[model samples]
Target: MSDRAETSERTTMAPRASELGDFLRARRAALRPEDVGLTPYGERRRVPGLRREELCLLAGVSVTHYTRLEQGRGTRVSREVLTAIARALRLDEDEISHLMDLAAPARRPAQPRPEHAGDSARQLINAMAQVPALILDRRNDVLAWNGLGHALLGGHLDPGDPDLPAHRPNLTRMLFLEEHMRDLYGEHWPEEATLAVASLRLTAGRNPDDRRLAELVGRLAVQSGEFAERWARHPVRTCTSGTKRMDHPVVGRLELAFETLQIPKSPGQRLIAYSAAPGSPSERALRDLLPQGRPDAEERPRAVLSAVASRG
Candidate 1:
């Protein structure tokens, strides 16, 4: 906790740059001449990948214009230009989305008060009795969660982290900072970590006016080198549905599929649910954690008897 004192002192803000430059630079370096159908002819290359001139030529933009873009000098880049560049760079959907995000102009609107989960949202999560469900806000703060969610994901952590805005648990923060949480992904930790950071990048771009989020980024960058490195990658992805490989200490290994449902009425909130296929061993293990028919003798802290979805 004392470590946060260092980051809390500065007024460093987010959108530190459209990150357009960093993303462009990294992507450019990742590509090779042969990969792009360009002949290098063993010219004793001094640069990492394609030169700024080469990429500009391939992207069909003037070298000067593309150089300015890579230097973070362009305040506003045209969509047509971005599209051409994306095509030239062979960017996938996610990478293209990220490129757009990084090139987006900055906004400094008034920061609104921390929004809490509505009564309906709270009730909705509780209603998902057998499934582990959680409500997250724009900043990836855990606003509310069902009992199963608490047992399934947060058994070793404090339940109150979802309640108070000041004490709320940021999903990206925990993925890197907490050991137990990091272990949840087991062998697939790299994918999980990358997706978590990329999804967070998307969220951060959309909520640039949120001061607490800005501070969260600063804090993470200062406290965890892993988070800092991932943040710099400028990865972008919308992780709506995915399969998770989790190893719970009690239930052994569980492979579950998860989905994210956006709340229409809520502008920046989503309900995430995790479940295993019916009749599978994973499903049976998950069911064992729920309390529909489980006896008291078999119940423990991991057994969620009812939805105590109250925020601490």
Candidate 2:
């Protein structure tokens, strides 16, 4: 594709300051005056939440300065100023980190690099034979998945799909665009959908230079109105661990607690493993999903599956 055409399709190609401004505006609009301990004097309010002037006063910044920052004209923002604004906005740690990223995104290579699960990461997931585990990139592209992971989350897909760079199943895409995945979450789909979008929002802010990630957002926004709506809300969060309620086609309903462990030295790459509480029905169902002849519980498997191979 031509450079201009490609750039046009990328959602992150917009100026960083503009994104920062939009995020600030959204967060500012969501907060009411009383929420921040400011008694409303009621001067015929027009805006939803704290006005730019009110926020500037609360943040200890001048109206013109805050206005410049909000209007995408402020290129150089200090950490102190950002911290002050974050406090006034009542932003949590994740949101503060997001603000910092928007103000000063880490420089990345202009080229998009191929993402692959390392040999050790694959070995680690396979070692946890009893657990359902998958390795995903910042964009939530499934780089690799153990057999149980495939069985639990994507039995309908080809087991080797993750090995293909061009065809890697993106979790966020499947959540909104794929029917089988939507069916897996059942009635709790909306909650899962929201969390997925919120998590993606953080990734989008942190990796503004990622063209593929930008294209993913653009495609989802165009194809899924629900995704577009949530994206517009600008939800930002870090879900390192959580419980997922799912209705598996094979195992039925399961309340599985999942943990996301970041791979050392690999930014945005993490291993997500899911398990149920001991003696619970969910645990029993999980056990049933394990591969047959998995060496006795006390013993490790003789070898890992070929599906977990590293890139050549």
Clashes of 1: 0
Point out where model 2 deviates above 4 Å: 1-10, 105-109, 292-312
Clashing residue pairs in candidate 2 (N, C-alpha, C atoms within 3 angstroms): none
- Residues 1-312 of candidate 1: C-alpha lDDT, one tens digit per residue: 443444334324424353677778878887887788888766688878888777887889988888887776777789999998888788988888777766777766566777667768877777788888899987778887777787788777666557656667777788888887778778888889888888877776666676777777788878777767777766778889989898886677889899998888888889999999989999999877774543331123122222233432
* TM-score of candidate 1 to 2 decimals: 0.85
